[model samples]
Target: MADLVDSFTPSDPSDKSPFTFLNRLPTKRLDAKITRAAESGIPQQGAQTGGYTPSYLYLSHVPLFPLYSDRQHELLAKEDKHKQLMIKAMNDADPDKKLTGGQKAFLGTIGHLVGAGSIVSTQRWERRLVGSNVMSADSRMKQDKLLIFTRWTVPAPPGRQRQGPLWFVDVLEQRYDESSTSSLKSLSGNATMLKVGVADGRKVTLQLLKTEAKGIKTQKMWSKGTKTDTCEAMTFVGDNEIVAMEIVARIERTASMVEAMEVRKRFDKEWLVPMVQ
Candidate 1:
């Protein structure tokens, strides 16, 4: 596996396809034994599922910094200041009544859960990776970029179905081998960095990598030397399938198309979203 990843980095950037190389990385399947070994490492015990099916692999594209710029915040604050008197008036008139637009706007600024987004929100989103199993890592990965060992013990609660997979991620910063550079370039090129909020209303930047093949689109983003409490660093790969369901509309062909479309959308929302998220 290591040899494959190491060799995957193309000698000539234009000569090889990075996505093809990445797609070819070995896919490891989990049986009862592998699951048990992974589960045993978890601090929290859970009912053992002897085996877990490999789900599809995906990359999450997150912003490198907060969504709101300093100028935006400054302007919003100034605008909110103008509404202070009105907000106070609304609060005093009906303390128990529904919140007004100004009140909501003020609250949005004060609260981290606003639609504008925040650092705390990003952190919470990142931690979602915890308790999820990582099937494999890119071969080009190493101490310089990221190093993920095949032998791992991920922590999980006993039978927490809501938890996607268990992961114990590690961070590293080292120089990549010559071959690895090509892979890195492929992942890094043209992909923009995003501004994502961190904890306590802070923000950071992240790089994006997006690739699609065989009807699967993998969008990835990365941050350097950043680690969460339980969630570490790892790329998760799983299995995804397209199920063909028959929907027959006896009266109208259009109705059948609509029904089929609805079913497909629902299928993607339910099965596909969970696998990637």
Candidate 2:
């Protein structure tokens, strides 16, 4: 069994497909294992058995930086602002106007700062999530880079039809181009798109429409109206549209941080280091 599993491993070191070991098993042997498990009242793991396991793209090996001090202070200020706004809204409510029970309850909650605090708390968690899992550096001295961690189906080996979809965590470098606004405007007027440059020189667009947050769309350059591929970077329960917009904001913030860090490094090299020398 060990030898059979080893045979399924991809020859390429970079091909970290998790299903390679199980999918490479011989048909008869694989069937027998499944049958034995069924006889023992245990289900086999795979699409065939209806057992699904999620794969995560971990950044444990990457060095992560603490949230920038400026950003931390900004979040704190925003939270305070939210609290003040909520309190003002409640106090400014028209006394002559009759309010529905739901409206009154909402006003009461907001007035107490519960609703406002929760909103700000969620924002803080989202920012921390990005800092912990998405923004990373190759080394302590390196500028932080934004990464999109997603699960993608591995392509079938050459000439062999895939028995089932095999998923593996894929790490993609997300590049932001501010100058591409004119080009993006040509795509769609209503939807906001993030044009990410992949490490392989391919352009991947993440479309966050005002109406929906379906998935990330990837297409080759200059291929307008062509069939594009879609993938999800992160999964969320309930309304994904809100989460998608938040992700776009987080990505932009991270990109800005990276840019700022680079600028500071250049300034240090040109002025501070030279003065010291």
Candidate 3:
């Protein structure tokens, strides 16, 4: 089966057409597995199923999310901002369809959540924006470069072919044997994103300015000589290329739902028990 899968190269790594390793799937059991994996966000977890959700949801499921201090902090800040806005909007609205213009602006995104077009709210909008993307020296002192991990551990979509939670990672600089443009075009999907941006010799560091808590937890210094934390100096790649983009579809969780309900239940039990007594 592995050989059979190996023989068929997906147009991209994610095509998953009916003819691919997918076809070998004995529909019912395979579907159950996929569904289970989707909800559990892992096959062994629980009553999880697979389908389309946002990239962030997928990020949440990963056992470990490794990011630089600044990047992780930025992402958290972004999520908080969006949550606040959502809370405000949900509270102020009439609950009926009679929406004011401001409410109308938010309808698209809300609708998307309930199965419409891929909508993003303004509060969380920049998270989707193609901001600074780059590729730098693995390390100047002790160089180590391998561009192969472009394929992230992000998951595949569940049922609907129409939904997309795509990603855009840009290549900032031109590196030897790397073409940012082609790489960007190659990784076209709804599950993951990669874009590239060029750095003009200025020392680049993604720093977290707002919060005191450093977001970057795990850092791999690919080279031996450098600081024990950072990977080797990032290499310049592409022709000043801001390249690569992936939008890997995410499978939202069953356990998270369970966790939420459990929390609410426990809270309610606590409150009700006190009141009854």
Candidate 4:
């Protein structure tokens, strides 16, 4: 017993023994190279491009979210039934009773996960360019003119088809003189006129009117102080007369002119600017 105890006894701190290998190991230094290498493992960011561009330049590459299809809906229903069964199992005390908070949260998270994995077709707006004839007419106009065509889907009015939403295509053109420095000076002078204001509802109303009219185009100065205040020619196509009238009526019924202007701004930014490159 004495010999066994001696063989198993711990060595002195200064003594070299089989276990001393651990003590001899060097502490790792915090090398900047190692830190940098670890940091390189993180994602590298690329340059970010923001703001609007012509639709013709990048519309085809835009990603679209697809609506749920009938088959997907059916599968979702089945999944829901399965979830209900599992929830009942989790709370066997009363199968028909409402789920407890914990069970509901668990099931809701699972539903989202399953839904994410399901397959569905995607959709994006169609886009093109118009007024090519004018662009080709003169080199000077070519430098100043930009025309973009794009369409966005809106919920169909009641009693319309459910397969897809209604699509409204808008043609927007931007024109400015590049050769003249005075043009830039004028823009700088009227900079405050470019401020966005809610009282600018008439501008959209007038633009809508020009869109409804045939063979007539209107150009306005930027002194209007609205985002849509910029000088441009616009036209709306592929809108059903009845639906267009209904939509216009809805806008006209907005609580106040300010609300209407806000709605207009929101729609342009969300639906129009996204088409820009």
Candidate 5:
């Protein structure tokens, strides 16, 4: 992961190209749109008609709470069933003994364990299993502080079929630190593990078990053949890699801006042509 990070070449901060790697990410683009709308000097509408005017449709990106895909919904249902069954078993064992908080927590962990093992079978399925939502300031702040790389999932492109190498995007959610026996945790003791919130209100424990630069061959919309681009990739650590890369890039850009400002300040402080003395 460190090697991959070291190998990354930061994009130009001043470049206004929307095709830039970060800008290309769906969530990043959505985030940018929201930010632009907020900054634009347009008069906001009344609460009765929704916050922004009808023109600003992208602002309405908030997901309904407990967002779940069909599979996630099924998993959740199974977990609920498991909990109910456990509770029933406890009741059957001893009618006098009430269910304790600890026991309930245990049952919840067991349920997640059962679900996590069956998250997805292949990378394609993994991409489909994930979903997207609006990135929140709070979530972004948390990710910026804790992770060296930004974590993101490569959501399947719109429509039935798509091609090309899967590029990772940073998930704008908080890290999961629930339980030691959590299914999100890496089974191997040697692997670095972190349970992170992904799309669809789902939490996944990713293990830093693999790292490689994947060559993504993408065909242009109008051009022929394919363009092979080397994408720095990692198994579960892609989030961390992106986070670190962006953070470093941000810091560098900020420093350059500050330096330029300071240089201007210094020039102003010193007489350019003897200060009209």
Candidate 6:
């Protein structure tokens, strides 16, 4: 999938954040337009000889505890039923249930195994997932003029169908045309993957991925120091891609051995999973 965003190369390679962190962020006030962010990325001016301002995208990471999907809920229910069955079997004291002394010893071993496995605990939250500030901070700190680029992490819950977190995900596709003073949902679908291309060109082949921004909410926030309006959105980071990959690994470790096992099994199956197992 075309990564919706190209990860940023830090101005200071030592800093792990995918953005350039200035000792003091520049105070120049520029509207969220491609013409303004040119100090960092490509210059949109003049290049549009007979043309106009280009587009910009804002993407940054935020720690999240994703809500369990419906399928995951079903799995938990099945596992719970089996657990009750196992508990009853372990404690049965009838003559048939009352095992010989040897059977009693075996039951003790089974109990220990159950205790060890019970740590496969998982957690969930209202689809709010993580705080909005944490989600947008990096992006707000990165580009001068920002245009948020997002991918739906998941559909919004029914009650919040309109003007809610889900609505922000839809905004990702609404490209703003400064000249027209309007916006439109672009059909140039493949625009997300281009290394570089003329956007107006038709037949764009776009690459896509499931960015962990399932229930994103973007809004105007006051930058207390500057007190200017800002845009923010949620983003995902998987392990093995950046130095922060270590963090994703650690979150899984504390969450569950099973979760860690599952992570290794799926992502680094040949290497880390076997070592842990």
Per-residue CA lDDT of candidate 3, range 1-277, in tens? 5432212223344535334434344434433332332222111112323332355453433322111123323433443454444334433332222445665555544543452212212222222121111010101101111111121221233564522333212211111222222233233221111221222222222211221111111121111111122211222223343222242222222221223223223322321100000
What are the RMSDs of all candidates, in order? 30.4, 28.6, 26.7, 27.5, 29.1, 28.6
**lDDT agreement of model 5 with the native:** 0.26
Q: Once model 1 is optimally superposed onto the true structure by TM-score, how far is the C-alpha of residue 12 displaced, in angstroms? A: 46
Candidate 2 segments whose C-alpha is farther than 4 A from its true place? 1-60, 64-73, 96-148, 151-277
Better of 1 and 2 by TM-score: 2
Give the runs in model 5 whose Cα sits over 4 Å from its true position. Answer: 1-71, 95-175, 178-210, 216-277
lDDT of 2 by residue, 133-155 (tens): 21122111112223222222333
Highest TM-score: which candidate? 5
lDDT of 1 by residue, 101-147 (tens): 77545544654433322222222222222212211111111112211
Global Cα lDDT for candidate 3: 0.26
- Which digits, one per residue and each the tens of the lDDT, describe model 5 over residues 1-277? 3321111122344545323333234533443443332233312111111122243233234221111123433433443444344334433443124446675454435534453212211211222122111112112211111111122333334574534332322211122222222332343121111122222332223222143223221110111111211123324333343322111010001111112223223322321211000
In model 2, pairs of residues that clash are none
TM-score of each: 0.13, 0.19, 0.16, 0.19, 0.21, 0.18
Report lDDT (CA) for all predictions.
Answer: 0.25, 0.29, 0.26, 0.26, 0.26, 0.23
Lowest summed lDDT window (length 10), candidate 6: 119-128
- TM-score, model 4 to reference: 0.19
Worst 10 residues of 4 by lDDT: 120-129
* Candidate 4: residue 55 Cα off by (Å): 17
How close to the true structure is residue 52 of candidate 2, measured as C-alpha lDDT? 20
Worst 10 residues of 5 by lDDT: 246-255
**TM-score head-to-head 3 vs 6, winner:** 6
Runs in model 1 with CA error above 4 Å? Answer: 1-156, 163-175, 178-222, 225-277
Q: Please report the TM-score between candidate 6 and the true structure.
A: 0.18
TM-score-wise, the better of 2 and 3 is 2
After best superposition, candidate 5 residue 8: deviation in angstroms?
Answer: 64
